[model samples]
Target: MDNLTHSLVGAVLGQAGLKRRTGLAMPALIIGANLPDIDAACFFWLEGAEHLGFRRGITHGPPALVLLPLVLAGLLWGWDRWQAKRGTRPKDRLPVHFGWLYALGFLGALSHPLLDWLNVYGIRFFEPFSSAWSYGDTLFIIDVWLWALLGLTLWASLRSEKKGGKWRRPAWIGIAVGLAYIGANWAISAGIKASSHSPYGLQADLIPSPPPLEFWKRDVIYRDPETGRWMMIDYSPGSAIPDAVPVAQGQPCAIPDLSALRKEDGELDAFLFWSRAPFATRAQGGGIVLHDARFYDPRARDRFSIALPDTPCEEPAGE
Candidate 1:
């Protein structure tokens, strides 16, 4: 999920019964939710695309969640206390219950990545150290129903929760609805894949996005099992795929030093990979396009193109 969304969730969590007990818990919880991302280091340290997959790495592995927090928290707490006793800065004194703080931080950071792993991308809860990857392959990155339910409930309860409203339970209910919605989203993605009959006979993987009011959209990647033509699907009513045709040369131009480009910005690589194909990039400079691959299409490239005036991709090259 996006940072804004995560922070919003954190805000809700802050106001919950927890606020009375732990006002600082909100940021800490949000941080804990995304803690699993610590594994992101693996992407840099390990070589090969496969390395990115779950491998029981330290960050994702179950043990780290429990053990790492304990070790780090204990070490930090001890260190902080020692420093405090040695220093005159009483304001910097450590919290007596740093353990709880550590636990909260760990939990908050862990949530984001766990949720991400639930998507088909999978996560190597135990990476580098272990090759076992955990994946539910269920749910889009974002869910409208989840946003509506949780966001709405949170908003509604914000002012009134002080007066009294069952807010915490809603999180559980929101999660339940999220799970059910995930199932439905999966069904919808499968249907879209069937309808497209992609070259690889893919099952569309849904992505959650805001704007244009498109409830659900899938960016599918896979070779047509039959044609082996390799395809990409920006499967959205508002997406480019709806009225698009294949490019002339490989989708992304053979940009000089693609590796260098990728190293410079991975999102560029993701986007280019998704745009890859037998098509020629007629318009030069940089642009975003979708492609079909096993993992994801229309990958997470952040490079911007010349802006258009009215429509998306409408700006003339960096407008």
Candidate 2:
């Protein structure tokens, strides 16, 4: 999920009455919500596909979830103390409770992985302990419907707060609605998978790719196990599963020999690690390129693919 969604969830949690728990409760919740993303700094040193393997690894795992909030709580606590010593602390600020701050931080940090797991881009929940990737495949990375629900509830909650009416109700209701919406999408995805049969008569792996703005419409990626062919189909809420179009149709391509290529390098290892539906092809310069079928754009292969050396050059003819 995007940072905006995470921040909104944190803000919503605060508006749901967690803000009154401590002086820095809101900050603890909001900042801790996005804290797991600290690994984003890896982009400074890791180039290209390197980030694929490193971005959602250990920082999103159990160990970091426990420790990162402590770091955040300590920093927030120190800042609060420093402000008091300088006599710059707001008189209206609630009393600082270190325990509450820690709890809020932990709660906020926990939301990161939960929301991230709801998207197609997998997260390593057991990293350092295990390098396994988990996917919710429930919601799009950015869902407009989710934004609307959170945004409307947040606005209503703020207005209620100003009037001293019931602010917590709106946020709590929004949380319930969000959970139901997620459940509906999960059910829809499962139904589609169950109803879909492979056109090639091979065992098929179906991946639901949600589109922006429209929550009901889905584009599914289907991989044929026997032939290693990729296909795609668009799905709507009430519509039946339609025939899939081959991803390689009319595209000039060749299947590179996977056994011939060296696969020990950092780039190759990273690509393999993150790609859920990987395939190989011949580059224009006679080099080998690897691609994930989910991001397989005939016009933009280079964007989601990596080039490898032309060493074991057994170039089969274009398919």
Candidate 3:
């Protein structure tokens, strides 16, 4: 999830709890919610094989998400005790302090991966053991409907905190249920993928995407070694119905650097990542021209170029 959504999730969690200490709770909640992204920092260090799928790899993996929160909880407990012992006697009215705080934070962090799995790219929740990607393909990176509904209720709840707030509980219930339902939606999406035998749909490994839910647009893209085509499936929000698409036959490699990408370095690895994008093409001035094939209009060249050789791409542009 993005920062704004993350912060709002935290604020909403804090306020949803309806504790008077929600003000202090907000920071703890927000930090916990976005905690999983801590692994993103590793992007600067890793490259190639060691780096592949590392973004949502081990750190955001299921095992790590499960273990990290407990570790943090224990650490927070020890810190609280240490702080209390070192200073003047800690006040008794700490409200819901360590355990709940850690729980909230852990849940917050967990939410990132859980939500991320909803998109086309699945998270390796069980990393180290299993890299099998799992996704719901239900939500976009940012869901305005989710944001608006959850955010409005939360903001309203926070704003009206001074007086006896009414919508707060409803909001909490809505969010909790919605998150669970969001999870369910993905399960259903996977079921959809599992059911049909459409060659294109199978290759795309289709999943639902967010926004404009009614249209069931934003096809999911995946590589199909079997068909030697890029597969895509357009899925409606809740319905299992699908429309399949596959890469045109014998499409040029477009990316000349495929073989070289396997041997990754800094800039080389960066270029390798960008190369995966469907419409990405090498621009004359420099980089690749990326096309948004999902929204591509055959009439207008959908290809968008990006300058590369941030240092240099030894690989040719048009293979």
Candidate 4:
């Protein structure tokens, strides 16, 4: 999920009455919610595609979840003290409680992975402990509906706070509605997967490709077991029987032996590590084009594909 969603989750949590636990509770919750994404700094050193493999890893795992809050709590504690020493501490602020600050931090930090897991981009939830990636396939990386729902409710919550009304009620409502919306999306994905039947040996993956506000629709990507050809379908879940998309429509692309190429190209190596269902196609000049079925689009040309120019196949390589 995007940082805005993460921040909103934290802010909403704070609005749900967690803000009264200690001084700076809201800041702790909001900052901690986005803390794990500190790994995003890898972009400074990691080139294209490499960040895909580096992101949503170690920082999102259990250890970081436990430790990041401590770091955040310490910083917030220090900031509070610094403010007091400078005679700048607000008189109306609640008493600072290190324990509550850490607790709020942990709660906010936990929300980050939960939301990240809900997206198709995937996350290494148990990283360092395990390099395996987990995909919820429940929501798009950025769901406009989710943003609108959460944003509007949060605004209402803040408005209630300003008017000295029941602010927490609005926040609680937002949380309930948000969770319900997420649950509905999850059920949609789960139901689609449960009802889907792949031909004997072929594997089919239903990836959520909700465009802006159209969350009912999704994309299905599959490779033919017999032909090794890759294809995609724009599917609407309500259809009891989707029209069989021709799997043997075209010749499968010859993919070179990736062992040596993966070792040579850092970006390709990372992309392979991150790609859930990767396939290849013939590129211009006898090179190979690599693609992940989850994000590939014919009209976008090579937008989600990587070109390996003049690369040799290892013996009987290619599909």
Candidate 5:
């Protein structure tokens, strides 16, 4: 999930009565919600697909989940103390409770992984302990419907707060609606996968990808077991599966030879780690071009693919 979603979720949690638990509780929640993304710093040093291997790893794992919130809680606690000593603390601010701050931080930080797990990009929940990727395939990374629900509820909650009306109900309702929406999408994804049948009667894998701004629609990717070919179909909830066609380069060409490719520098290692339904082909000039079936688009090859150099110019190897 995107940072905005995480922030809104944190704000929603705050509005649901957690904000009054302590001073700076809102900050603790909001900041901790996005804290796991600290791994994004890998972009500075990791180039190309290398960042994929590191982005949703250690920081999103159990150790970091425990430690990052502690760090955030300490910083927020220290800042609150410093403000008190300087007499710059707002008179209206609630009393600072270190325990509440830590609890909020923990709640916020825990929310990050839960939301991230609801997307197709997947996450390594057990990273450092285990590198296995888990996918919810429930919602798009950027869900407009979610934004609308959270945003409207947040607005209503804030308005109610100013009027001293019942505010917690709206936030609580928003959280419930969000969870229900996610559950509906998860069921939809499962249904689509179950209904999918391989064109050639070979074993196939079904991956349901959420389209931007369209919560009810999904793009399903089907991989051919024999040739590594990918077929795409647009799916709608409660509707029949549409005809699937070859995407990007059409039928799977040939599997490129990667036997000679070096893994010491972590290029292939990273690509393989990040790719869910990976396939290989020959580059225009030479070497191997690796891609994930989910992002296979004719118009956008460079966006989700990596090129490996120094391979023999031989025909693609048989599966």
Candidate 6:
């Protein structure tokens, strides 16, 4: 999920009454919700696809989940002490409680992974211990519908609070509606995957590829078992009809024999590690182009794909 969604979720959690738990409850909640994404800082040091392998790993994993909130709680506590010493603490501020701060931090941090899992970009829930990726395949990376719903809820709740009216009600209702929307999408994804039939008797993996505002449509990645060719199809759960043509490149691409390149090139290795459904096609320079089936788009050729122009190309193992 995008940072905006994460921040909105944090604010909603705060408005939903967690803000009453401590002096900086809202700050802790909001910041903690986005803390996991701190791993993105690797961008400065890591190059190319390396960040892909590093991101959403240790940071979103079990150890980081526990440690990050503790660190946040300590910082919040330290800030309160500093404020007290300076005699600049707000008179109306609630007493700062480390226990409640930690609790709010935990809750907020937990929300990050849950929302991240709802998208096609997978999350590593138990990294360091296990580098496995998990996906929800329920929503697009950025959902305009969610932004609108969450943004409106936050606005309405804040307005109600300022006017001395019922504020928590709106926040709670917003959370409920968000959950229902996610549940519906999850059911749809699972149902489509279940009912989808591959004429070649292969399993289809459905990825939610709805436009920013729409959620009824999706795309699928599946392999032709007989030919070992991977293909993608735009599909709608309601219609259950598979498109006759594969998306992007009309013909399916083959999985290259990556054994030699995987061992020699660190960049390609990282890309392969991060790619969930990787495929390779011959490039114009006689090199191979690597892509993840879930995100490949012909219009955006440079994105979601890496080119290895110097390496000697090998025939695809499937060939």
Report every candidate's CA lDDT: 0.48, 0.80, 0.56, 0.80, 0.81, 0.81
Off by over 4 Å in 6: 196-208, 240-242, 250-254, 299-303, 311-319
**Model 5 lDDT tens row, 1-319:** 9999999999999999999999999999999999999999987898777887888889999999899889998998899899999999889999988889989999999999999998888999998999999988889898989999999989999999999999999999999998898899888887666662523332335778888888778887777555446667787766775677665553234555454553565767787778887766566776656788767655545646777656433443433
My TM-score estimates for the predictions, one after another, are 0.53, 0.91, 0.63, 0.89, 0.92, 0.92
Q: For model 6, where is the 10-residue window of minimal lDDT?
A: 244-253
Residue-level lDDT for 314 in candidate 6: 60
Q: Which ten residues in a row have the lowest lDDT in candidate 1?
A: 304-313
Error of 4 at 56 (Å): 0.6
Span of 10 residues, lowest total lDDT, candidate 4: 310-319
Residue-level lDDT tens digits of model 6 in 1-319: 9999998999999999889989999999989999999999998998777787898999998899899999999999999999999999998999999999999999889999999998888999988899888999889999999999999999999999999999999999999999999999888777656763544233654444454556877666666454555556666655656653444363333555678978988778888988877777667666667878777766544646787876455654554
Local error of candidate 6 at residue 274 (angstroms): 1.1
List the pairs of residues colliding in candidate 2: none
Better of 4 and 6 by lDDT: 6
Q: How close is candidate 5 to the true structure, as a TM-score?
A: 0.92
For every model in order, what is the number of clashing pairs? 51, 0, 23, 1, 0, 0
| Model 3 stretches with alpha carbons more than 4 Å out | 18-24, 46-52, 66-96, 166-168, 180-216, 220-227, 231-251, 254-319
| Residue lDDT tens for model 3, 29-56 | 6766777777777657864333434667
Top candidate by lDDT: 5
- After TM-score superposition, the amount by which residue 277's alpha carbon in candidate 5 deviates from its true location, in angstroms, is 1.3
